[model samples]
Target: MFYLTSGVLFLLVALSAPAYAEQNLLEGGLLLTAAALSVMALALILTLRSLARRNAKLSRQKQSFQRLLAETPGIIAILDKNLLLINASSSLKSLVTEQDHSTLAIPVPLFADANGSIDLLPEIRQQLKQQGIWHGEVWLKNEHHCEAFKISVHNLSSHQGKTSTYILFGQNITKFRQLAAHQQQQQLRDDTTLLPNQLLFIEQVRQAIASCDEHYPSAALLILDFVVASQSEREVRLNEQQILDIATNLKLLVPETLLLARFQHNIFSILVPPHLCKQYNTIFLNQLAHKLIAGFNQVDSQGMRSPLRIYIGISISPNDGDNVDLLLNSALKAANRASEQSDSALCFADSANQQQAPDFLAMEAELYRSAAHGEFDLYFQPKFSISSNRIVGFEALLRWPSPKRGMLPPPTFMPLVEETGLIINLDRLVFRKACQQVSYWQQTGLMRGRLALNISIQHFTQRDFLRYLQDTLTEFELAASLFELELPESIFNHPTIWLRERLHSLERLGFKLILDNFGDGISSITQLRLFPLHGVKLAPALVKYIEQQEQQRNICATLIRLIGYMELDVTATNIETEMQAYLLHVMGCDCQQGHRFSRAVPAEDIGQLLLKENQLLNNQRQLAN
Candidate 1:
């Protein structure tokens, strides 16, 4: 009877919805007795309660599963055979919130290999199919940026049920990678300056040498050592801060193409690429070293100052030596020699050329003896007016005719003279000789233009330089206006109020000052802006390539125009070709000097050039008339 009641209840529930009955079933007496109806109703109530209990248990289980996924830091998902997301962890919502969780399809091409490969997902899936698992790293891009993840994939299938799926887990390792990079940087960088340490510096040199080619012929290494004076308590603290400040300044000053390192305390090294090494001469590098020294002695952020000195030693690859140890030793030796001189603090490593290398003691002795005996002769290089093609003046150059060696250029022996502190004596002799020669020329009616003289900064910085200039001019009975003092732009590297006052004193004495090699130093325009000057001489190499390069021509033209507007005289040197001369003339350059007019001649030969220039002026005047 119980089974019959349960079956009757089941049939009624199933067929009642489609039954087209006019009367109510409970009211009808033909199909049921009172007891049978009661049994069917009881069975229906029991079935409904069981269904509600099962649903409640399933809802609670789902909530617990979601809570676990939400707390997890990584991503977990199940995918079908077509790589459609069957279910995803709550953590994935942070990356793609608007994605349809019920059916999310990600193509294989969407995943990029973290190792910079083009495709990774297709191969990973194939490996999973064969090996039942795959593990690797990949990159995923969302709306903002890409992130790296370590991914693990597992293949799952049931023998009884033919359903198959993949289990995927992803762990974010971006911070771990960054920590590794930070540790590596700490190992390779200096603690104080944050520049590359000595070991890394040597490694860079080795790599540069290994990569050298015909097109890239050489690389240069410059090691700078500083001489710091005794400092007070406040200055000592500032000194520590200065290291970091100077490092930051140098990084900004040097181009990205070069490598700068802090080899040791107060000693920095720079690696010059082949192109720059070939382009810049030793003199320019010396100017760079001086600029850095000036920077070193500057007041720190706390306004505390210290006395500092810098010397630089240079070595070039395939010339000084190709090996790292040899280069380091050679540069350090040169630096040691440089630290003893005032005229210059830059030295090149000794080369293998025996003819050029002389014993230091013997050379110093010879230089001192030669200075005492006045063995130096002056050579003159004539300057000419650009538009008129007339000789304007001559620059007196010093030449040493050594008795032991044939005529030696300044580069061959100036450092030795400077080291012996005999350069000041040499300068005095040159000054007196130049004044006497100019006086003689004027007396003989051989020359009429001003005479230009070259004076080293070491000599010019003397305490009584002004008094010596006055005395020299009086002794020769020559007026100050007839002489133009040619000072290199490098003099302005050490900016000081005292230096400015000295320059003003010279100008007050009626001497015409000319800034020589105007564009060679780091502070060319800044020098011009800071001080009063009579004239500017453009760098010779810069003028040489003006016509060949349009960019160079434009730069020259712009500079010339700006200087002309300042009402200052402009002179361009190394005008070798007629095209260069014509271009300068068109650009309104005031004067020029080059082989086009004449090479540097002797004092006696100057009369001939003056005579020729006078005749040319006469011809032009006659033609104009």
Candidate 2:
């Protein structure tokens, strides 16, 4: 450094002395070189400073990353091509067999065969061996631990000039399994009381299948359902949970061999072994169904009146699916189809391919269009007082002039519409048409009695069905009293606030409200305090089955005795034979409807009947006076 500085000073002195005694080019060149060297030295100093600052920044980043890796609690691991773990976080130590030096290896095997189908496991293992990367859930077994984890593995190139290695990140999700078992407990309701729940009796069903080690043993899944016609929010909330509970109780009674779960609000899924189904003895299945239906009548431990329903579907496996998800899905589809068809229950093995059952989308479409376009017509059968033979009222029974089919009765498709939410529109049309016909009858001086229309409570409870009724009544220019809205005993269900308000409003406007098919369903009469009803129509089932089913006849007798004290008028529908009419008259039934007097007739037939009756009554009165 001293020599360089001395050269610079000497050159400067020569240049100033005009070295060689002249202003020569050599002096000029020496001074120029000195000036250039000073600028180059300054540039070199700045470059070195920049490099040092960059190195310091990089070192800090490396330290920060190292600290993060050491502090993270989740399972962070690296494995070789063989899937043998090389590195993992300390928290994952318990997941592995501890080594002498003490480190962790998060094993992957606890998630194996979780859904009972793992054909992909072996294939994944082979790919991971070859590629050094894989991602999925796997079951890992240790002496004391078994758990599930979501894992992701990556084949990473080595930074330290070594062979590439695998890095994995996993976090045990044991809680997830527990939650899965519990989620549906809240989603679905019991069929009877409609409680929130489903603990699919898996162990019982699995054991049953195992017990039948010899025969054509297989498990079947059943789904059951119920549809309420009320659309009031108050009714829905009150019923939703109890409905789930009812479904739960229903699932419980289908035999230990059947794993029953409340899969939907109105549906129950039952898993049963094929051979355990009693060797084609359908009566056994029907017995089981009856038992479930009966069980729904029990007052829950909470003493909440559980007015529940039971609809079931069964799907047997190997026949349905080899895996749980598929089997469960198939069973659900079959159950849905059964509800649509109003079948006692359905089997997944025999249902339509599109569903676990043929959703009969065709039937549903046909019914929907027919109902929506008012292709279906109503026929009013006179509901007359037996004692006075007075034409007090008429029950408007819906009749579908199906495009491809003849007149379809209520049992044929009312259920489908109710389940599909199409009944709301259908009911509206029925109301308007019935009212229009009644008005026409009045104009002909043939109609002096009120018209009764059945209201699907589900329409009032689950959907925004109020508009339809309000609009139809306005369009027909019919007084509320001119029409009597009929409903099931279920309408008296708990939490009747909204239902009461709507019914009372309509009642005050002069329309009468009636309960049809009242015997047995909707056990709670408390809702009646809120309902402004004019009468109850004994369900046709009660009357039609009376002679055939002793139990049904007795129930009808009891209802006839009790309902009157409540001051509600009674109408007997489906009084087929003269004998049935005598029984109804003996029971003091006020009015009757059935083939005994006349079948449901069109507007023209009713008009003529009403006109003739009026003329006859006038003549009788004149003669008596």
Candidate 3:
């Protein structure tokens, strides 16, 4: 405004004094030039002030960009067009040496070749030029250790569309690689003993077989099955401490170079390379087997040797059919055969033994067909009251009189039946049959007592067992009081709540529940009292030598007394001798059933026995009169 005001006043003075201007034109021109110079000076000052403000703003932005580059956790760098390092983030410094910080071009270690022969920089540059970007993993080695980085590089273009510089970004992936490797290793190892699991073991076996040749003709696979023996008929399981001790002992006996793995519960496998058995394969394996057996004979707290048995089975490659599955199956079959024999604890795979092996598939199929067609019969064994010498009840026994294999007993096929999960079906059949027989006997007006049927634990614990029992009895038009369910002592092994509820349900239905084979398993008095049991049958083993062995007699007497005190009826089974029955009767057990009275017979024979007992009672009454 000052310059403009001065210009306007000067113009007005010059216009008003034209005659004076003509007289002093040189002086007026110099005055006009001075005014123009002043205006130009003021414009120069305003432009300088605006430039100063813009420079200050640019400086603040430059500082912020520098701060972000310095503090960034990821690696960042800027390289000139010639690939010389212009700037880099602070995180990049840790991955490089001091010399790398001072150097202009990218560090040599970033593109180091694994074989120290190839250079990767040319390839990277080519990719960046063609695609405008490059990405891959790179390994960098410092003084302390090596590190892995996943890096990406891009071409920074100028305003004229030409490549100006290169921008690089990287992430450290060393820890991630390590964690993935650790997880893979864990997946291939057993959690309990930290040994290679079955999956890894099979891989090793396959590798061994693939590497075999004529020079190395045979490799050995040994399957060691460990068993703990107890006097009781129930299964004995090894505790954690016992398992650890066995593993430790086996490790000491075997060489560390061989692979040892836990194959299954109570089973261990050892892989012996062909080189170890090149000269004396049999001698070496036999020695190893003996050593394993001796190691297991550890002394217990009572200073007595432990009852641990080790069965070793050996199968050689190429001779035992070659592949992983074939070798494993052959070894298992050998181990099973070793277990069956009493004299030998070790066996080799052979064709004869393999032929003798039971075909479980065929047996399982036969069981399914038998259950579907109702091709089974029940035999009744009369239980007599020792005091009155009269028939009280009959225990129903399952018998399969096959046309191909006649007179097959329960022990012959029941185990397979249970294993194939067909026991439930068979039990249901027996129950329905028992109900029908009792109903018929009642309709004919024959004197029939409570009929006992052995019920499987799996069958009895079924959710619909009670309902089925009620429905079946209702169909037969019979009362539940005519039936008795004999359960094994193993029934107590189930959840207490479930077992109690099932037993209570049966009791509520007016049926009697008897614990069979009471003294043969891990049964306690507490279990006996916990459930609603009407009686318990003594195991046949306990009554086998009660007449000859005084110790056996005393044990039975004590058990009978204990059961009698609990207000539960005691029945003795397997009484084959007259002396056995007399002794049991003297011990206060009034009910007995065994071959001494009669072997299991058909329903018609049972009717005759009942009639004979009634006639004897009548004659005795007449004699007393």
Cα error, candidate 1, residue 528 (Å): 1.5
Per-residue lDDT tens digits for candidate 3, residues 97-161, read 45445334555356543333455567777777777788898765656547677888888784422
Query: TM-score of every model?
Result: 0.48, 0.46, 0.50
Predicted model with the maximum lDDT: 3
Off by over 4 Å in 2: 1-359, 462-464, 524-530, 545-558, 611-625
Tell me which of candidates 1 and 2 scores higher on lDDT: 1
Off by over 4 Å in 3: 1-359, 618-625
For model 3 the TM-score comes to 0.50
Question: In candidate 1, what are the lDDT values of residues 506-543, reduced to their tens digit?
Answer: 89888888888876665455567678788888888668
Q: List the candidates ranked by lDDT, beginning with the highest.
A: 3, 1, 2
Best by TM-score: 3
What lDDT does candidate 3 reach at residue 87?
Answer: 77
Tens digit of per-residue lDDT, candidate 2, span 355-455: 51333445677887776566977787887777776687787888888777677898766655665678877767777788788778677667667888887
Candidate 3, pairs of clashing residues: none
Clashes of each: 0, 68, 0
